[model samples]
Target: MRGFGDAAVEEVPDPVAGPGEAVVDVACVQPSVTECMLLAGEPIAMHTVLAARLAEGPVRFGGHEFAGVVRALGPGAPDGIRVGDRVTAVETAPCGRCAACRASHPHACPSPAVLGFTGPGAFAEQVLVPARTLVRVPDGVTAAQAAAIQPLAGALHGHAAAAVHPGDSVLIIGAGVMGVLHTQVARHGNAGLVMVSGRSEAKRELAGRAGADLVMDAVGDVEAAVLAATGGVGADVVFEAAGAGTFELAARCVRRGGTIVMVSVLPDHAGAPLARLRERGITVVHPRSGGGVFEHALRLVARGDVDVDCLISHRLAGVEALPEALAITRDKQRYGALGPAQVDLFDWDRAA
Candidate 1:
């Protein structure tokens, strides 16, 4: 296996799917999270990463969050999935026979081959995936929208478990993608107030567009700002999305009986201010994957209930533009990529 920070574009022959598989001309690539890991010299680092390419006929391409349309369907796949059908894909290649899968816990199967993180991914022109792996993109949905939905589903998993009640106020730490989704879900659940705390104004703007009512720049007295939003009552729910010194801010923002939802990966040493929670009788909501969360996320988009399109800030196509498009995220244009647009990966690949 290669060392971390060693991810480079290594070309392989065009793949042809065998029976029970489908070949999707990747229509879009969702960036941000995966690129963060790769930039840190950990090309293979991921939440649900598969082992590296072993004997190597079809090597890996590091894009797990993706969407596309089936260009060709292999034998044995149902005819309902025609060539022109648009779809989004996930990383879990579960063995349906496994105990975990039988219990609807495929994401946590002992052995799973995910799309880009673990297996061949959708970053390229054509991604070969099992027929069962793809989720049909609903009508009027763009590829970028679908691509973004996958992560939103993961975020929703935690939020749903927390069960934000109507008239409850929500406090979200970090205006990153996860934080944005948390705010959206909180609003959809009829939260009394949606407050987001983040470092950058740009992220705050994004959060607002995604339905946050009040935005707080957490550089100073974030905890106070949150309390003020609730008239000193504190928030009914808090989400630690930033995983920085945010636990204190989050813990302090919640009311006596409020709940805290941990949506993203936090450091091992990043301890929560548990004494506050214990004293307040606050519950910590920890949600796992599965539960057909993505399917629910798609339906939310289809209904136009969740304004996910507001969160997409950038869209780039083809291999040539990838390098520069990738750079904008780090420089002045980070998150400046605005207004959700459909990503057509097939067009980019064929053009390249």
Candidate 2:
């Protein structure tokens, strides 16, 4: 993105694999709606930082969730990573040489390289990634499935952070891709009752099909329904995946001493229900991305435990379709998109 609300495909130099890095020939990529909001320069903390950097010059923007073939290995790249191997890479990794790493606090590393946001992402035909971040695509997992795994990994992280026990009631405050993924995770973990709240009937239906025990109309009395379903005690865990204003709802719906996992990135000034949370002794958990969740997510998708196919709502062909695909991703509500807009980099011959 060149500036706020600006996105385009332009000729740029192909990236070279630096030491410890590898270049990937992207087979496919999924455009994130959250990244689209960031490209438009929303005041969200991370996006604000990115926008400041963009003020200096054009940056290769987006395509964090992608899958591809290994094109070349840089000096000292793992011998196991060979050309033509299918893989997907983690988008962000802490710089191991940072002070935080020396202190055994890698998560607090002052300088983290975030693909698509902090550096050139996979929006183009090729992208450079740290070779260490690459995970081989397991047999039977399609390129599209691999491309969509990052967020699934994120959902996994959120589920783990919630620390839900067996027979717990789970309330998800949105029925978008992340919400439904959370629903599936909860169901697989043996949650007693899994409920989803969504504004659109289509998303509600999708959530039900994705294993939600009850789909509550987000526009209606969601809290009442959730409380009623749980014998007026409320859910044991609430996942606030809907972004911004939904945090208040999650806070309100969680049982006393229950957990509310903040899954969405929010703007700096989104109001918090501190008083209510404190009074109820609700535990709020914020899980960051990383630490091998990608590997676990791939295994789940490969084993058919998490159905990524249900999340994908649209598929377009080739890099040329990138602009239109991004537009569709940005207007997800209009498109009824439960997941990111997908673009196929391969199979153009068949597409043609």
Candidate 3:
């Protein structure tokens, strides 16, 4: 990104692997909703860092959610990694010397290196990543599926935080990528009833197809519908995937002492109904990252437990289509897209 909103394809020097790093030839990459928001000047979490980067001139941005073939491994790279292996990586790696890491809570590391945000990402033909972050792609999973499974991993993290029981009712707010993934995960995890609230007709249909037993219109009385569905109680767990103005709604829809997982990357100053939540004894969980569950997410995809490919509504060929892909992903409703827009850099079937 040259400026706040400018992006164009240009030749840059190919990345070289350093010690404990590996160079991956990207096969499939997708522009995340968060990345698009940042590019569009939304004051989300990474706005400050990205603004600082743009001040320096054109920045190589995006492509954390990707899959590729290992092209080269630096000295001290893990023994398991090899050239020609298909893989995807955990985007965040904790700094081992940090207090959180030293205390065995690496997921809480405050100064972790984020793949697409902290350095050069896989938006190019090749990207360099820490070898330790790489996870070998299973035999049956497609490159596209690998590239898109990061959000599913995040849904898994949120489900774990909610500690959902077999019969717990799940309510997901927003029928975007994260919301649909959370719906599928809830169904597969044995949740007795699954409900989704969405503003658009297309997304509501998508939520139903993703296994939501009930889909409610977000413009209507979603809380009343959820309450009626749960026999005047409320959903046992609510995943607040919609950004900004939906936290209070999530609180209202969840039963007392139930869980609400904030799955969206909301702005820092976004308000929450703290007093109401406290009075009801609601547990609000903010899942930091999908750090430890990449492998499990891959297994779900490989086993056909979750359908990741169906969510991909737009696919453009080659890295040159990144700008279009970004546009579609940023405004999915305008593009009628159900998931992140994927850009295929190479034919995975023919790649070495």
- What local distance difference test score does each model get? 0.71, 0.87, 0.91
Angstrom error of the Cα, residue 274, model 3: value is 1.2
RMSD of each: 4.0, 2.0, 1.2
TM-score of each: 0.83, 0.96, 0.97
Candidate 1 yields a Cα-based lDDT of 0.71
How much is the lDDT of residue 123 in candidate 3? 89
Steric clash count of candidate 2: 0
How high a TM-score does candidate 3 get?
0.97
Clashing pairs in 3: none
Per-residue lDDT tens digits of candidate 1, residues 219-278?
A: 878877887888898998888888547777777889999888876565445667777789
Cα lDDT tens digits for candidate 2, 247-338: 99998899999999988778888899899999999999988888588889999999999999988889988888888888888888887776
Cα displacement (Å) at residue 73, model 3: 0.2
Clashing pairs in 1: 5-41, 27-345, 91-114, 91-115, 313-337, 313-338
For candidate 3, give the lDDT of residue 157. Answer: 90
**Global CA lDDT of candidate 3, please?**
0.91
lDDT of 3 by residue, 1-352 (tens): 8877798888989999999999999999999888998888889998998899889888888889999999999999987889999999999989889888999998888888888788889888999999999999999999999999899999999898889999999999999889889999998996999999998788788789989999999999999999999999999999999889999999999999999999988887999999999999999998866455999999999999999987898999998999999999988888888898899989777864
